[model samples]
Target: MSIVDALDRVCRRLDEIRACVRWAEAIVREGGSDAERRASNEIRAASFIAACGAMEQFFRAFVEWLCGEIGQSGLRYVEIRLSLHSIASSGDFRSLQSLRERDPMFGRRMDLLNRTVSTKSCSLKVPRDELGLGGETIRPGQVSNVWAVFGLPGSGFEDLGQEVAMRVLADSRNDYAHGRVDISTFLAHPECEPSRFLDRISALEEWCFHCWSAGLEYLDSQGYRR
Candidate 1:
């Protein structure tokens, strides 16, 4: 797809991710039994994986296109790839690597590409265990520095935007996974903070509204949103 088309897809994916997060939160708030809660959390996890996958694909291709258009070396590609991993683990790359161990051709290509682009000095670091339901315990000297790069005016701030979506998904799902509370009690508790699940829908709605405004600003700057 063309760069613009890809960017549009990225934005749409982010929007869907946001929607899924809201729905998952609602599921948690609506109340259900243990089996029901597990089912809901599993669905939420699947949604997160799918949305994150789309975000990663769009981000990588978009970076490559931008770098090619600007006649820049692979540094920007490296930056975008690394930044995209900020929201989750680089499981795709790891899986690819695992496959490459049995496929020499893929291994050769990945090796060459790794050298062509310097991976050092990246603003985004891969999370140690993206699959873990809670905040990972950092090993000694592990840094959790978070940063995101904005696409050129009017494209989209998808790198950070996707991260926000993932954060909510991870947080809410984690709470559900740990049996913090069933959906009914969570919803009934007026003083519950951390949103538990449904308590945070309003906040998510407000966040999305603001995000749309920011996206519009980006599009107007690019002569697209207006």
Candidate 2:
């Protein structure tokens, strides 16, 4: 699909996540079963996790698409695309002297890196998630790296209060998705913050909106719009 199509897909997915959260808000405010877990686990929290995952996947694809647009095969690896894209996204006025500050072992063609319209058979390796997120998939740094590299304005995932909310939602999502123990084990550490679940619905909404807007804005600035 075209980059435009990819952007539309991300927008639509965000809309769906938002709609799901709104429906969740209008549902029975409290319950204990899976269907009733909207107050805690079901659509409210689980869907947020799904939204986060979807956003990461979209950004990965966008990076690859950008690499290909710049005449490289987008197939080596994630960092391969992201690192190259980061360098490419910067302006030609960016000096190699400054770049050397970030890389003590800078031993490449300075002119090629500074050339505005040139392709290269060279690149540097960076931390795999450095261009978008921290170790936590849904934390403060989410897509901020991408935003900076692309010269996009403002915060990405940290746009709202989601830096904290995303963490809370992600951790709770882990427990709900993984920690299905027996009632005896559960009773020992009964997760009893139903109110937090309701609050997370709003958090998840902010996260989804931020991801969509920041992601689309970055892509659009890069010449992909729909």
The prediction achieving the highest lDDT against the true structure is 2
Query: Over the stretch 190-220, how does candidate 1's per-residue lDDT look in tens digits?
Result: 4233233323333333333343455345334
Q: The CA-based lDDT of model 2 is what?
A: 0.50
Clash count in backbone of candidate 1: 1
Candidate 2: misplaced stretches above 4 Å? 29-41, 72-138, 147-169, 180-226
Clashes of each: 1, 1
- Which regions of candidate 1 deviate over 4 angstroms? 33-36, 70-226
For all predicted structures, in order, the TM-scores are 0.34, 0.45
Top candidate when judged by TM-score against the true structure: 2
The CA lDDT at 14 in model 2 is 63
